[model samples]
Target: MLALFKSLPDDGSYNVGDKLIGESAAEFIDDITDERVVSYYDVDELLEDIDLINESKALLIAAFGIRSSIWRPKLADAIVDGSIGVPVVPLASAWSDFPGDYEQLTSENYPQYDRSVVQFYQYVAKHAPAVSSRDYYTQKALEGLDISSRMVGDCAWYDLESLGEKMCKPEKIDKLVVTDPHQSQYFDQAESLMSELGGMFPDAEKLFCTHGDPSQSPKRQELASNANKYGFEKKDVSGDVSNISFYSDCDLHVGYRVHGHVGFLRKRRPSVLLCEDGRGLGFTETLGGCGFPAFTRRVPEASSTPKKILQTFPEGTIHQLQRKYLGGDRVSHPTTPARDDVVDQVTDFIHQELTTGWHRYEMIPAVIDETYEREMKPFIREISNI
Candidate 1:
């Protein structure tokens, strides 16, 4: 939301609509800190009510869940049917799962179970004036579909501009915050890493915070208990902005949540993102630092090769594969459907981060800054035209 405002001209005005399914009214109030937002409406209200559409110059869909099965088709239909007359734009959009290879998608090679995924992107490519992807991976994935897009770093990175003064690499771990892994299967690895970190900075005040509510996820609730066992004080930062603000005050973070790592980095603080999925890997690859794969060593020997695994279980979703092999729980909520299971590379990056401090790798932040500029340039230019 902040990124959209930051991209605009000083006098530019816009209304904000949120499409997040489970988000509550109170949460929205807490999350939206900007006064410049002219009005707020539920995504349904924004889509159904033509009055809101008439008042808008463009409809910009902002941030994650851009590749969702539920909403993508609805948005695509609205644009195609002329219900939405204004230019449609998607800013910092990303695939929930990384597209492993780029080729004409088909039943044999298409990674996603839903064929509509590519169709949705194709529709936006034809109808929308501009589309901005969150990472190089997402850009490459879209390119395979012959859809041109600008590779804008995630909108979260733009929060750095507002937080530049406060962002810094701490010399000592005076305070620490950790966001744990979402799955029970990864808990042992997460705990081992946390134990090592705790030993390294015994005196640092530590707190465990969740990106989502623990009450909703059985695994997350259990993870919170493990954090407390490690002497971490459990802190509930329920709001989106509040979560980032909490991390900004912390000296360092080592966690499983992608946004937690992003929150810390935007504040110029050091963080280690335990890459359990493509989102973490994508962010790490884009910034050129501060992430490690928690489950690299856990993949069975027989299906270790990424290509072999994909070929053997072409239709097997992330959830299905994880349950069969990794002892992951089957949950009611829809997870990010992915084709790739392998964590690209396992390295000593985490060790170096915890031992030497993240600032030593000066090139990482420089790369992040460079990417921000390179990606945002095209996005700004395209959005201005809209």
Candidate 2:
């Protein structure tokens, strides 16, 4: 989720804490040649294909759903191939369907701009100061989740990597759990926190892409069969979880579906999109007045998104399907109370991103550890003009 780039103060040349480069840098893809052709929803052809797959060496792009328009051009081609310093590894899905790959897969473990990914798309395309995604109230969701977790600062990553090791005993496999394909409405507000985390993690393994989508009716399949009569496992979103190292040796991925959390967080395991925030994002009437269109999805070509207030619809499709692919345009029709308040806030944002006092928020985001070495290595060495 760390694609932070922000730069869009309506080119009245933004000054408030001066830091722009959002729309996640139009999904940066500097140039991964095939003559740099890209288009998941074109963030400037995903930044010219991350300037061309960072001139090549290591780019494993394979998201099962949340394609930051395709992992922000494989991470701006690994930040312009500054020589296989390669860390652009977005293989998302914690039930992701591109809700910015469930926090861009947790902002790829933080760095690059406080909320990175082009600074939450330049503070929601030039207005800045985030958190509202349509009508949050509980003390403004606890002061906008503690000012988005203290503007997530002190960031650092690019050292830990592994896709096959964290399961010493995720609770001995053979569980075959995959509940019936939930029909989004956030499983009746996440059936009692998914049965209190399946009764406090009772040995893992589960599934369910759905077994009835003929336009779900019977009262939404009796509230998705009362959370698929516990211990869900119905498979076939391509059956057998569509191999990507066998869906990254599933130990846990309890979904409300964001894209199946981009297929098991692209296999690094540990995903939980669960979905929440509400209102049909017209672009910025609120979600805290702008913050998380992954840099306003990329707002340049003769811009227009910072009119001040009244248009922030955060009823959550990650700010309405990435602001229709970062503002390529389209916002009207699918407004049944923000689709049932995005199924009760994607089951309360997946039971509050998987319960247990989540240490009452605090791990990163002071604008990514005081701007990683003073503003992203001099803005990635001047955007690799190196």
Candidate 3:
């Protein structure tokens, strides 16, 4: 078994947080299989080495975040030509129509254009026996492109049940706020929000935490400065592994970043997500009914006060969500390593496809024709009519 993990940029300027997905995926694979070789490569590098990939018995694509469609055409071509040599399995990967609409395929730009989107779906549908989606929105997005996907939530959620039970719920808690500047509209308000949160919990330690990317360090420093001004401190976590420790030390977590909320939840700590986009809202909606509460970033007026935001969901809601989403007994006691059925399902698919010698030779042409008809034909027809 060969796992193809996503590689960071060659410039060495990528964030450590970006590696979290790949790392977790590798670890999960390691836990399940003993005969596995893990390799990391950028999209271009992977495309260049199609021959090397074809030598492998099975290929696993470890994608965690919203995948860009830039490499879709080439990847699909490689698969259709049997250059990959084996069945390509997408594990815990997701494609979102966020920041754009999937239906209105013509107007979008290169990385998210209609044909590219269709190609990605076509590749998955024809090549991959089963695709694991991170959330409902992603599953629907795949379905929109005539692809079927299973909603397994994020892979990070797999081990959370055990971790949650191991953590102690605090009566009086210190608050940790994870901030980022990507959401420019809410960036400036972070300081004020921290200040107000600090005042509300005067005796409790309010810490400003960030993903520790150097590019975002300046903004983190500014947030830290604001926190210091309001008697709050800054905590710098070195990597994704250390985030668990940082989150465990805090009582409550409020953050704009999805992983920030996830890190705290893994530690069995209460967390609130500052929803800024479809991804954020999807994460919230997936976990909200269970225990996690989400506050909209754009609607600052609605969740004006820290107290109001914190109190939006009841404590029982947190426990319930943790139980359902994370999967464990209601009691705070840990269970015997709750089975990761999703991992099992994926591994089974990989084994079955490889053993059955699934070929895309015949399906490739049909997939291409369908994609052209569904995606490209509409635009071509409109132009011709004009």
Candidate 4:
């Protein structure tokens, strides 16, 4: 069986940063599946590559942050076209509501967005055999669209068992702050928080980290510039290996990226999440009991300062959150479902779906070769003015 895992763009051009969700999902699936696993950058490429599509038994949409309306159309299209030929299994993903306003689903406010979501789910229900999401809220969002999905938590959480017990607060401040370039609006606030943390922990070795490509992001460049000014150092954490390596030593993490926060948690580091959107808030709320603490961009009127918000959670609170969330002692809460059985269940489902007589088309290699020559020679000649 062949498994194609959808990943972030791999075009020669640089991307913002390597997405941890895509990387983690691909790694986890690779380890567990007997099928040969391959990674593709975009859905369009997957749709166009008939040879790849024809050979694959399963396609895994490695979407870590899938809850936004922006993704609805492409996902819907993938479901409609791809499912006709092969089984598409979306895994370890979450749905996002608009930032700060948790009560409002984007679909309710944006009619076109709602339509896209509904259409996608309608196709998913008819075509795709199974789907999985990161948390209960995302599952409910899918259910709202009349699509059934398994709650597997985030793929990152699958490694929790290996992280050992939760850790207590460190004596000295060795903090790592993860930042996002897209959220420019919050840069001032984040800088303020960093300044406050610096004042509090004079001897603290605060570092500013990013999971994305710095070359592509103005916000990242700006953050890097301000790092020295705020008495913090800048670190680029673009891939899974770097993430694991960097988080291995940090005592505390404060960041806007959900996966960045999860990376810290996976290493049993105490973390404070700076919530930017639905995915951020949902992830924190879902796993808050498990040990994640978050403050939304929309700070309360009373706590005007972002640093003050961080101060609200004392060292004792941080320790408790870590123990409860990552310590392995706590039971699976409703918000944060246990992921112990997800890998086996998802693996079994993929195997079952692949073997259940999914349609396959017989292609003549000679015809493909002839077609390639027929299509490419003229195009090359035209471009060359031959």
Q: After superposition, how far is residue 98 of candidate 2 from its true place, in Å?
A: 14
Best by TM-score: 1
Backbone clash pairs for candidate 1 read 167-267
TM-score of 3: 0.63
Cα RMSD, each candidate: 7.8, 20.7, 18.0, 17.7
Candidate no. 2 TM-score: 0.22
Which is the better candidate, 1 or 4, if ranked by lDDT? 1
Which of the two, 2 or 4, has more lDDT?
A: 4
Model with the higher lDDT, candidate 1 or 3: 1
lDDT of each: 0.55, 0.31, 0.49, 0.52
Residue-by-residue lDDT tens digits, candidate 4, 272-362 = 6666555666665556532222322233334346445544652223323534555322221222222233223323332332354211101
CA lDDT, candidate 3, residue 28: 47
Candidate 1, which ten residues in sequence have the lowest lDDT sum?
8-17
Error of 1 at 138 (Å): 1.0
Estimate the TM-score of every prediction: 0.74, 0.22, 0.63, 0.66
Q: Kindly list the per-residue Cα lDDT of model 3 for residues 277-343, writing each as its tens digit.
A: 4465556555542112122212123334643553454322433454465432222212111122322
lDDT of 1 by residue, 1-386 (tens): 21121121111111011212112222222233321222233444556665566455556565534442535445567777888777767766665542222221223454453666667667777877788787766666566567788877776665534422433656667898777665555666666655666776678898887655566556767777777677687765543453445566788777777767776675577777777655677777777656665543222334345644554543336455655765445332122221133222222444455566554555655555666556565565555444
Model 1 CA RMSD to the hidden true structure, in angstroms? 7.8
